[model samples]
Target chain A: MSSPSGVLATGSAGDTRPAPVVSIRGVSKRFATTGDDVVALTDVDLAVAPGEFVCLIGPSGCGKSTLLNLVGGLLPPTAGRVEIGGRPVTGPPSEVGMMFQKPVLLEWRTVRENVLLPVEARNGRKGAKAARGRADELLGRVGLGEFEERYPNELSGGMQQRAAICRMLIGDPDVLLLDEPFGALDELTRERLNLELAKIVSGTDKAALLVTHNIIEGVFLSDRVVVMSARPGRIVDVVDVPLPRPRCLEVVTTPEFTALVARVRELLELGHDDDGKDGDR
Target chain B: MTAPADQRHEVPAPAAPPPDTRVAWGERPSIWVRIPTWISLSGFILVLFALWYLLSSLELVSPFILPDPMDVVAELGNMANAIGTGGLLAEALGITVLESILAFAAAVVLGLGFGFLVAESDFGRIVLMPLLVAVNAAPKIVFAPIFIAALGFGISSKVALGAFIAFFPLLVDTAAGLASVDRDKATLFRSLRISRRKTFFKLQLPSALPFIFAGLKTASVLAVIGVVVGEFIGGGGGLGQQTKIAGDLLATDRVYAYGIVLAVFGYLFYAVVAYAERKIVFWQTPHGVQAGG
Candidate 1:
């Protein structure tokens, strides 16, 4: 029943609300282990509206990644359903592009070729060749124009991830599923990429659901930050960021941004305490 | 951590310099380092050669035991003439080269086939893995007599022995390589809805090439050894048989001549594989040094 603030479910007066690009309803995932079945996520319901950015943030083991996977259609829900572009997701949906913490660029491939992977995967070699101009444009947008012919191993970590982002966009997917895509970068590089990412997503109709543990990053980028609790991962809070759009690195110093960060940290600690108390039973 | 606004932009820009994109053929030592290295190498060899010539010419050792360097050179000239004219030593050398090449080819085909099978399927792994381990644990040269007994004194026996010896390293390395595909890459492939065939060819196979080549390099050396050992046991035509005959006849110089030819062949075979590895797995740095950002 929880929806991001300002994103109204029912149109008041005569306003028409757009349908979400990604919809997950009562989705639960349990992983079978030797001792017992591990509940990764339980009764997870989420909707990412087109042109909105949502971040899932929690301490480790909260299964933020599991929720992303559900939307990505990489993992099937044990209960309920997930829909992308109004279609029930039974496999990796062509409408979604997923990225992990690691760039996952093919070392043998040139950066341009790596960016064209998804298109090639979907539409074959001819499709990839047709998309080369777009791939180079994406790379150039991320300051990697000169490095397109270089291999993944030849690029720096941030540059490689930039190439990976171009790869995700080359498929022209409706939704982006990012699982800690910038979690591996240094603080400065992470901030710069965050700015680039915001610019990349702002004018587009694509919805982004990013999973991150960093509180500042979530607040800086997302319209709403979905906080989950540990282990039997449940949505504990959905902190709305009312910060001004096109935020820069200076926004972190503002009282509102700092307040939002402190609130999320408090909720995370509360979740940790709750987990500790539950273990005593 | 909050940095001053101006410093924030500065750090991101300078944090990563453009990575060295050139193939790490190797870190080419500076001319300063190269000159000294060459000097030391040639100096050591010259000293050894001078000692060898002095020890022989002064009769410090009997001629039967150690021939003069000049005599060895003369013997080399004779062997070269024999090779040019298609003499016995030349035929033996040709047979040895043919056996090594054939064994290496057979080992590569079967090793790659079985390596992939074991790596890709549970049934193949469960049944063949233990058998491979057991066979690999044994000294492969010892099996030459068994191959000779079954296949007789022929080129086939030598090739069989060579392939049997060389096959293990390639198979083990290949399986390890296939299994070592990055977990994230697998997930990325799955997320992209890439076909299983494309995933194998595009992602897994290229990643496994380095390991497969490493195994091949080891197999190359083993292939030659296997063929020679088989020839030694079976008295088939090869440098191994020629050397044995020369030793029995007290033709010490001829034995030395055959030894030199065999050593050259082995080195060349190994060099050829190493060169191929460098070409095929072009991304990998020589000596496994990861080229840095």
Candidate 2:
């Protein structure tokens, strides 16, 4: 089997990398309920290279989000360990920035203020003021420069998400974790944001792990797509997206992209069928 | 893409033209709305004064029963002179104001602390909330006599009554306000790995400010009532005591004067609370003004 282009790209740079930015080692999460233990994930091991765009795709209740939270140190693994930059996952690391499915903008603050929240929370006024220029720059990059003074309620769904993305990037984190950040948008808007996200990820040095259910979006935006099984989720397949660099909407219509989407879809279908038998386990 | 004037005319006109033109034409009358509102308000006051004056003049109302407005005004003037010369009315008002202020401060601090505690912990909520509801449901007026008997007829008794009356609203409103935080926002904070204390300050407190102020507004009015009740039940120096003296002497005009002073005092307390609510929660100013008028 051919190695992933992402690995090859790093290999061709003439430096054999020593360690991945994030590594999940035999991680499993089980939640306790009345008289039963609900296994959410089981023996999930994955590694993401530095600056790589990795996408996790699975059906609902498949523990994709659980895994994302585990990697982010929001939740501890029940069985194994999750590490970031060679550090054992403890609490939230300032080096890792996170964004949720919703915009999660503080309604009381303006757009500019919302984008500067992490900077203010992690740092003080001096850091926030220093980050302000960068916040405005990101907003302009995301086409929201004119809306800095507007409240979150006044902005449309897509604009709010754009602001959220700017917020995620404002802290200048080395790693970005997005849990279905565009899952709430319409199909048209999601496709548009997929392209925007691809451009943003390519432009930054941050390693991003995106959890999504959209197969096409997974193929279009990721360097490597990790397909997950249903509840008690584990990696079923890891497909390398061979699409060329600087992808756009037109890439979705290509045969190579469609074949990759089909392969991921097959893995998900098989995972779903296996999940049916494992329901009682 | 401009249509000819003839074709524009051919397009049927709306049954009612848009109000833009009418609003501009009738701008003068819109300004007059405030004048009529003020006039109607003053007119109602004038009607009340007229009835009082006419009934008292015609002897249909006994002077000992309902004194004339003129008589009340004259009494008020005389009392103002007496207040200038170290009379009970001014001294009583000063004592009442001091008592109410102390009680209000204590109520706010204690109520906020307890509210936050009950809201943050499940055990506190389960253990204390039911007991609090029982205490709140009890007739707090009974506590006035009990407090006067226990604490004696001094500033402490009145302050205790006022604080007791004021505390319930602060507790209820604070709990309600903290509880009113959006669940989605809480989940967002959880995913961010924000600490519980930070979440309370950053998310819960601001969101609950409006409700807490609503409680305080209600409590201000209750605080005034509590002080007056304390004065009435216990024999202390306040407007209520002066009112009692006027009632015993059958000097109806002096009673009316004291009643007016009490009304003004209540209105001022309410106005101060309303003003504070406006300034502190300015984010809700637009909505408050719209709803108030």
Candidate number with greatest TM-score: 1
Model 2, global lDDT: 0.79
TM-score of candidate 2 chain A against the true chain A: 0.90
Model 1 alpha-carbon drift over 4 Å, by segment:
A1-17, A274-281, B1-39, B54-67, B286-293
Docking class of 1: acceptable
The local lDDT score (0 to 100) that residue A175 gets in candidate 1 is 95
Error of 1 at A265 (Å): 1.7
Go through the candidates in order and give each one's DockQ.
Answer: 0.39, 0.10
| TM-scores of the candidates in the order shown | 0.88, 0.77
How far out, in Å, is residue A124 in model 1?
Answer: 1.0
Docking class of 2: incorrect
Model 1 over residues A41-145: C-alpha lDDT tens digits? 888777777988999988777888888888888888899778887788999989888888989988788889999999999899999999889998888777787
Clash totals for all models, in order?
A: 0, 0
How many angstroms is residue B269 displaced in model 2 relative to the true structure, after the best TM-score fit? Answer: 2.6
User: In candidate 2, what are the lDDT values of residues A162-188, reduced to their tens digit?
Assistant: 889998888777888988899898776
* TM (chain A) per model: 0.91, 0.90
For model 2, how does the per-residue alpha-carbon lDDT over B21-125 read when each residue is reduced to its tens digit?
Answer: 756777555644657788888888899999999999999978999888898999889878877987767798778777877778778886787788788789769
